[model samples]
Target: MTSPENAPASRGPVVWYAALAVVMLLGVVAVVAARSSSNTVSNKVATAQTSKVKTGSSSKALPQLMDGKADAAIGQIIPAVSGKTLDGDAITIGPDGTSKVVVFVAHWCPHCQAEVPKIVGHLKDSPMPVGVKLLTVSTNVVKERGNYPPKAWLDRVGWTAPVMADSTDNAAATAYGLTSFPYFVVADAEGKVVTRVTGEISMDTFDQLVKAAETGKAPS
Candidate 1:
């Protein structure tokens, strides 16, 4: 055997290279671990962002309204419908101790076109009484339909009521049991449905309905 100091120079270099190889292997493992941790953090942040998003009008759908049918939805609490407006503002129709006359209209309906201007003029002449609010839902929107953009139509008519922009699926209209354009649902201060009528209604009839809702009484 060679003396200790006479060990092969090649042997020394081999030992040094072995040690460097082990260190390089350890460094690679550390980098992999760091990358995995970062990816996990990024995935968690994405999940949290997705969970906070709110889409459409309501979390749960309400019972469908069957107007003029036996066992109608009258005397039932209206569902709390939430949606955004034409101006991207949030709005909700709920039991807030305020009487509400909610009307559902489609931009493509001729009756709605005729009815909206009349209602607008009526409201301008005699505003809703205190604690009674008038609200409109723009629903069944189709870009190819007449009056493509409802905001422009309502603005042209000088409508001042709070207008809720219904979802692509007509969530607001469906919640209110809308079967036809110019549908109307009157709710009392306690959020109970006073009356619901379909088709265009005259201002005199509309006034009566509002009175009934404000007093929590059905029209006789």
Candidate 2:
């Protein structure tokens, strides 16, 4: 009943509409697939980049040293703490049946900045006695502060000690009851604390503390 020219015109409109609908559907599906793929990739990246920190339980926190009187932490076992190094290598500092002289330092502290080089130089001149392990903890890190990246600062000072990178929550510091920068904890072979000292100390004093750890005796 329809004329030929009019029939063709009607068919043309219907065909064009169907083609446009197909194209729109395909575009919507492509966008959805792309968004899902992007989310999956982002989740994988976040998981792979996460840093881990592990700390052991402590019965009592170390008392803050005031005028050389805080020896409460002495005779207590040093907490078993484990964390990663600057290069992402795993390390643990605990009672490993070896004497340990652990020093905790913050990159921004002036005293720590002055102390590291002296320790490094001393170690270079006189290595620690056999069976004694010297460990360093990089803590209280602030990217906006001076000596921002502790690894670079330590490397520049020719530090050869194994470093334990602390977490953002200062977990290692808290586990050890850190009260100040340039903190020292001397633990004997059984992991019992022999003594603790803070602030910059003379290498002679440092040697004495190391001796205390070696002998399992608290310094006088």
Candidate 3:
């Protein structure tokens, strides 16, 4: 039997409770939004870090070669050479217990530019001897030279031979007696230098050199 004006006084506690619930709900919503924002930021940072790692791995700096004439000689035991490939894999020469026909080339030499493809084509048509391995050394790399980056040039020509990048000091080339561009060194299974040829050579001459290396005799 309360009067109409007194009804509001009875509902005061209920109105206060409803307002408190709304405030609590808004607080929960705000917290959820903040957490979502934090997660989005974290994901973006992780993605950027992953991209940086991939970029760092793909681009590697080329080395500089030392200035000097190679001292490699026939009948001499050549030292072992180790280096990385364009793909960043390690390669070691003369340690696999196999005869090798090593070709040394420079990116800027016109003769080498012509001779490399020739050698690659000839070898593809007529493979090396059973126990003989054909190896290529990319040496004397220079930024201002033709075929600036040797790896890209070799890829364009489809050079399938196992290639080793010489050190900044051109250690591999120096060890194998690099007297000139497009140098060929034939070595026996025990890593002994059997013979060497400088400048461009015919496929027939290359075959003779391989034969001489396998038989431990000079080509007549």
Stretches of candidate 3 exceeding 4 Å from the true structure: 1-72
TM for every model, in the order presented, reads 0.71, 0.73, 0.65
Global local distance difference test of model 1:
0.78
Candidate 1 residue lDDT tens string, 1-220: 9998988667788899999999999999999999999887542211110011133343343356565565366887777777677766778876678999998888889999999999989988888999899998888887677775777788899988988888777767777778888988888999888888878899999999889888989888
Candidate RMSDs in Å, in order, are: 19.2, 14.9, 19.9
The digit string of per-residue lDDT tens for model 3 on 1-220 reads: 8789876556788989999999999999999999999887542211110000111222222122224534336666656666666556667766357888888888789999999888778878888879888888888877576665777778888898877877666767766657688888877887777777788898899888889767877787
For each candidate in the order shown, give its overall lDDT on alpha carbons.
0.78, 0.83, 0.72
lDDT of 1 at 136: 85
What's model 3's lDDT at 202? 89
Q: Which 10 consecutive positions of candidate 2 have the poorest summed lDDT?
A: 42-51
- lDDT, candidate 3, residue 176? 64
- Over 1-220, each residue of candidate 2 has an lDDT whose tens digit, in order, gives 8788667545778889999999999999999999999887542211111135687665344555556565778788888888887657888989889999999999889999999999888988788999999998898888777765787777788888888888888888888888898999999999999998889999999999889989999778
